[model samples]
Target: MAASLFLARRSLRLPFPRIVRTSKWCGVPALGVHTTAGRMNTNQQDFEKSQNDLKILKKDPGNDIKLKLYALFKQATQGSCNTPKPGMLDFVNKAKWDAWNSLGSLSKDEARKSYVELVNNLVSSEAPLKDSASLSTREQYDTLQVVSEDNITKIFLNRPEKKNAITLQMYEEIGLALDEAAKDDSVITVLTGYGDYFCSGNDLNNFTSIPPEGKEKMARDSAVILQAFVRKFIDFPKPLIAVINGPAVGISVTILGLFDLVYATDRATFHTPFSQLGQSPEGCSSYTFPRIMGLSKAVEVLLFNKLLTAHEACKLGLVTEVFTDGTFQKEVWERLRAFGELPKNSLAFSKQLIRETEKEKLHAVNVQECERLRERWLSEECMNAIIRFFQKKAKL
Candidate 1:
């Protein structure tokens, strides 16, 4: 198993400085605008204010409010949503596209003005924007810490008491952070865990709280959110690095396969107990692990539930390096800073070339895994296992 894994790892090693030239697709042609300098400044001010209001409203808004905000923002920025409507079953996307497209022939300035007015009205009647933090200012999140400086963004899993267990909200916040990282070309993202562990995986309390009758609904809903979160990582164009501080389990361990680099503390360990939990593989590990660690090692980790030490993980090529616990975080950050100092486009395009070939296959596997996971979530075996697992935790 080790020999085959080693040979497979050799095949997956990235080629440096090969410079694969590729054509870039620039989406949405720029619209011509004829406005006086003073008018441009006024329009820009209104746009900025509208953006701030939208950010404030996003703190806690109903689905209706969110859709409205999305529409107004898109209209103001893009000038009337020229993209084709999403498919029928894509209800959320279609609703957003329709809402934006409804304001047909509205000019950018007019849309911006309308957005400001709508936000002001919403704030006055329903909620006050003053009560919420502006989106421009980074608010400290409950479950994660996102700090960007020196051209490196570090996203830390902050719920140490629960062993950094990921809640649904944490997943959303991580997705948002990734979205931000995608927009900013200057920064590289580094994901790490706080306290003694990287991530204990999903907070089972959230999953077990679903009533038996609501299992199917919860399965579908959670799958949608989880799939979106996983897709964000898979499609992330910028360099993403993972720093494993300690032991990691479940999705936390599997997710390392998607990162551009993974550095771990010598004390860190990785385990995927999906089968024990009556669940299947996630984070496209079903596809990526075999490609990284070979089929036999992938089975041992995903099927037989093997727990690998950091050194073993590095040997299997899942981790780039394993550092002593004392200096792990510092060393990882230093490397990230060094990486950030390199030519940004060169790194990004290199990563793109390396990953673009596997993008379609990874997406397909993610879809298939989500389908299987949904079934597993709704199954009697999974339900029973979850109950027992919770009972065991309670005893502890």
Candidate 2:
């Protein structure tokens, strides 16, 4: 299924007119030509062009292509990959880290040249460019509505009847949306729910669907995907803002800690019931919540299973602001659109500066948290807790 999704996404790429901006990089020559342009440093041009090419890619690239892009981008921008490879169990991060590191001593200029050539080849072979809105609207998953307009990408959780309860497929779609946002420099992402509830967290059916004896494989795969999703949020280059239109529960609440800004309606509430569910924290909330709200507050949410009102969450530093329920969406969109209008590169660079110091630590915590959560998911306590939860819900 994963492989098929990969192929589907990659199958269509719109041919884009060559647009390169001029900038200087460490002693690289400025080039002028049809595909290449004037005043831009060769390396910088390649880097920007590669980013543009990535934006047009209909799907996430294969691991090899992704690794090459990661390595080349890092080489061109940061000179080398300094972070250590993630632990083996963290297959995704390790693959990414290793890919960047594999460039070894490759010069920035050479990396830039190779990157530009690769993108040029891909662009030449792909489909003609379509409207940006068309690309964003093309892949509509059952549970997500991804709309990109005026430099803002809004992802609406669409399962109102289910209180927007998330399934594995929803996770995949959200991850893909994030991937697309990452590639497009102009887009700032906003996450919200379609109806009254932001999300009720993981769909219980997702848990019950796994066969009892063969659950390990499913659990492992889920852990990888979930961790990858959270990691994408952690490492998202552009601004990510969450508009909490209503209540959010479990992983939904935990994810708020990772957003650049969070706005909630007056009637909105937040809860992380990891302890109540006999689950350890996911989403690296263990690390991020403490950093954002202090250890005591983090414990209150994770260990004590406290529900936080929007005002209370704002007071605790989890929410950026709260708007009246009637005007919530309007106000949030107004702010997001204003934010989107600001100088794009400045926002990106500032975000990068704020995040750089903690990047490695966040990845480490994510690895640790996922491992512990995997253990908890398989525990007898968690099994009993699940049975009890459904039984209580059934009675209600």
lDDT against the true structure, per candidate, is 0.69, 0.68
List, residue by residue over 1-396, the lDDT tens digit for candidate 1: 110000000011111112111111111124334456987877767656545554433222233334555666677667767898899878666777787888888887776675666555434322211333421224657787666655776677777556677777788888898888788745588888655567767764555466576757777887787788889999998899998877887778877889999999787889887766677888899988999999999999998889999999999999999986534555666677798788878888999999999999888988888888888877888767656655765675
Deviating ranges (above 4 Å) for candidate 1: 1-137, 211-213, 391-396
Candidate with the greatest TM-score versus the true structure: 2
Model 2 vs. true fold: TM:
0.65
Error of 1 at 368 (Å): 0.4
Give per-residue CA lDDT, model 2, range 79-135, as digits (tens): 888887689778666766787788898987777776776555434322212465434
Cα deviation at 286, candidate 1, in Å, is 0.6
Error of 1 at 46 (Å): 55
- Candidate 2 has an lDDT of 0.68
Worst ten in a row by lDDT for model 2: 1-10
